[model samples]
Target: MNLKDTAARAAILGTLHKAIGDELKAAKRELGEGLRAAKQETGTQKISVSLDEGQDIGTASLVQPKAEAAVTDAEKFTAWVIENFKSEVERKFVTSVKPGFQKKLLDQITAAGVAEWADPETGVIHDVPGVEMQGRAAYTRMTVPDAGKQAIAQAWQSGALAHVVLPELTAGGAE
Candidate 1:
């Protein structure tokens, strides 16, 4: 009700929120493994778990795995792209080609995330130089129906929480 009390409550709630988030990640990992195993054994790609059978709840489903790529060396990648794929490079010169713009290696690599980069002329698949690809396993994706989301929002908006916005706390205590 008071400033000090609200600050204390918010501090405690913040800690609890972080702990809950860590636990949720671990739980999700376990659930994803189970989902993957089930899909493998049943030869099914689409697997979902109902949050609650009798209640209107969210559902968690196993989605396809994706790959992640990151450019570790920007200069090396830029040189490689210029030598290998000239068309992918963008040149911006003010006076001459001496101080021209750098290649868009990061942009091109990011746009080509989780996909193969092929040579334009040769049509041969080539790995982007200085870019390392990491394969991410299929993870469980959770989805809440629109109706459930609306109900949850309404409930929260109508509750005591509506007026309990966390204020900017001072270093040692409430201002």
Candidate 2:
């Protein structure tokens, strides 16, 4: 209402805005560092393929193969991997990362003060962020509760997984 009062209010408001901005920046910086560290430390392994001992896709297989049993097993396994690889790899990747993501989400949300997120989604989580509740559910793909897991799953699907499309391997030998 008065000049001095208005000036004082503006100064306080500006300082408050600056402080809030500074705090938010610090929060983001810390979070980024944390994520980097987690990426290094956790380093979730992708679902890798191992040839069955009897199948002979690798060094050992070369030595042991060509028997009727070996050939049949190899053929069956080749067919199986060919048919189910996309889904199998996808499933392994999802399963491996789900727990980590969920734990991260639980920690982040708890720290962020939104601890009441239901134990499980009443609806669906999507690999696509901001797409949950309809369309394609995404985060559920990796089965992780963390937003990072959701982001990673989406990236994995659209990035490497998209490129690889399908993978093949053979196995052989005795064990």
Q: If scored against the real structure, what TM-score would every candidate get? A: 0.48, 0.25
Alpha carbon deviation, residue 23, candidate 2 (Å): 1.5
Model 2 residue runs over 4 Å out of place are 44-175
Predicted candidate 1 versus true structure: per-residue lDDT over 1-117, tens digit per residue: 999999999998887676556656767787878878888898554543332224454667888755556656667666776776576566675211122222233334446874346
Local accuracy of candidate 2 as per-residue lDDT tens digits, 1-175: 8999999999977766665566556554654455445445884222222222222221100011111111123333334333433332224422222344435444444443432233244543312111112122111011233554455466566664443322211111111
In candidate 1, stretches whose alpha carbon ends up further than 4 angstroms from where it belongs are 45-53, 65-136, 150-175
Steric clash count of candidate 1 = 0
